[model samples]
Target: MTQRYSVLLWLTGGLVVLFLIAPILAIMPLSFNSEPFFTYPMPGLSLRWYEEFFTSNVWLMSLKNSLIVAVCATILATFLGTLAAIGLARKECPVRGLIMAILISPMIVPIVVSAVGIYYAFAAVGLLNSLTGLILAHTALGAPFVLITVSASLAGFDYNLMRAAANLGARPHTATLQIMLPMIAPGVFSGALFAFATSFDEVVVALFLTGSEERTLPKQMWSGVREQLSPTIAAVATMLILLSTLLLIVMLWLQNRAEKQKQRLEG
Candidate 1:
């Protein structure tokens, strides 16, 4: 009976995986279709759409904007969030619980609601329809993920090591940079990936905050969906999928490296 149950569970899991992945797999071939439409059984496979995606000025500009915003947001979020997490991990930190809730509230609140609120707030401050505004908003949305990851990394951290560093005449900042940051690097990097992904793919906030000039890749894709409905969007999607897969591979590698480092440290 147990063996039968185990086999059934395995089959169910495999089916679930297939169900989730099949749609994404289906889209790849459509990107290569020689025709403009998204129909199945392509008449021929061609790189026409890929060529269009690369050659189009609009798509290229949007891609550049996305990279700029994502990279800036990720860097800011990682730095600020790492500091916040380190502070919270300290035993003497005041109002840790309340601070944590406030820090992570952006992730909790509904995205549309946050966008609306940001829209109004930015308008008041004249931050609307600008790359700087968009980057700041993305940083707000992404910092919580960084905080969570770094906090988890700091959970088993050793305060005694900091004291030892101090006793050895190292300054607090020096100890943190030299000793603590190195140990928590995996978490910082993982959080950075999450921040970059969030900033890169965020559409709702982009729609609310940006003008056409500042549009990111997702915004451009949304525009293409509404206005053009071209096969170039499919090619862009395929490229994004490839990029996501690369990021996932890097994350897995980081996780494995972190585990080995942890073991070595513990040993």
Candidate 2:
């Protein structure tokens, strides 16, 4: 009975994985579809849509903008979130719980609520529709993800090593760079991946805050998706899937490395 149950569980898990991957995989062949419409089992297979995606200035520009925004947001959120996580994890900090709550509140709050507030705030500051404004908003949303990942890593972190580093004449920054950052780097990198994914996939806030000039990939896709359903967007989706897969691989590697580090520390 137990063996039978185990087999059943495996089958169920496989089904779930297939379900999740189906839509993404569907986009792949659809991109090569000779039909302009978004459908499969094409009369012929061609790279026409792929060519369109690459050649179209609007699509190419949006892709560039998305990459820039994701990179910038990832860096900013990872730096700030890693620092904040370290501070929060230290025992000497006062009101650490409160600080952590405040840091993560953005994640808990409804995105629409936050979007409205940011829209108004950016509008007032004359930052609406600007790259900087979009970056700032995405960074704010992405930081909580960084904080969550880094804090998880720090949960198993050693503090005595930090003390030893300090005693060995290492300055605070030096100790952080050599000891702390290395120890927690997997978590930091995982956090950065999440931040990049969040910023890259985000659309609602971008919709509200962005203008024609500063449109990200999702925004461009959104506008085009409504006017006419085309296979070009499917091509973009496949690219996004590939990018997401790469990031996921990076995150998994980091997580496995972190686990090994934890085992070493514990041993």
Candidate 3:
């Protein structure tokens, strides 16, 4: 009965994976379609759409904007989230639970609601339809992932290391940089990857906050879907899929390394 249940579980899991990935895989061939239409059994395969994506001003500009915003947001989110995680990791930190809840609330809240709220708030401050506004909004959304990852890394941390550093006359900043940062680097890196991916793929908030000049890749894709379905969109989607896969690999590697480090420490 247990073996039968295990086989059933495997089959169920495989179906779920197929359901999630089938649509994404279906588009890959369409991206290379020579006839400029998304259809099965393409007339021929060509790199025209990929070429267009690279050369087209609109697509190129949106890609550039996405990179800029994602990079900036990742840096800001990682820094702020790392700090928050450290503070919350402390036993005596005041209102630690409350602060963590507030910090991560953006992740819990509905994105549309958060986007609308951000739009109104930014409009009041004259930051609406701006890159700065988009970066700030994405930072808010991405920080929670960083907080979670970094906090997990801190879970296995030994306070004795910090105490030892202090005993050896190391400054607090020195201890953090030389000791704590090394031990937690994997989590920090994984969190930064998540932050970058979050900002890169975000659409709803980008729609609310970004102007024409500040349009992101996802916003451009949304526009293409609405205005006219193009193979170029498919090409971009394929590229994004590749990028996401690479990030996932890196995150998994980091997680494995962190686990190994933890085991070594414990042993």
Best by lDDT: 3
lDDT order, best first, reads 3, 1, 2
User: Considering summed lDDT, which 10 consecutive residues are worst modelled in model 3?
Assistant: 36-45
Per-candidate clashes, comma-separated: 0, 0, 0
lDDT of 2: 0.90
Residue pairs clashing, model 1: none
Which candidate, 1 or 3, would have the higher lDDT against the true structure? 3
Tens-digit per-residue lDDT, 10-78, candidate 2? 999999999998877777888888888765567888888889989999998998899889899889999
lDDT of 1 by residue, 1-267 (tens): 999999999999999999999989999899999998889788999999999988889999999999999999999999999999999998789989999999999999999999999999999999999999999999999999999989988986778899999999999999999999999899889989988888998999999999989989999999999998998988899999999998889988887888888788789
TM-scores, one per candidate: 0.97, 0.95, 0.97
* C-alpha RMSD of candidate 1: 1.1
Q: What is the lDDT of residue 220 in candidate 3?
A: 100
Off by over 4 Å in 3: none
What would the TM-score be for candidate 1 when compared with the true structure? Answer: 0.97
lDDT of 3 by residue, 38-118 (tens): 677889989999999999999999999999999999999999999999999999999998999999999999999999999
> Cα RMSD (Å) per model?
1.1, 1.4, 1.0
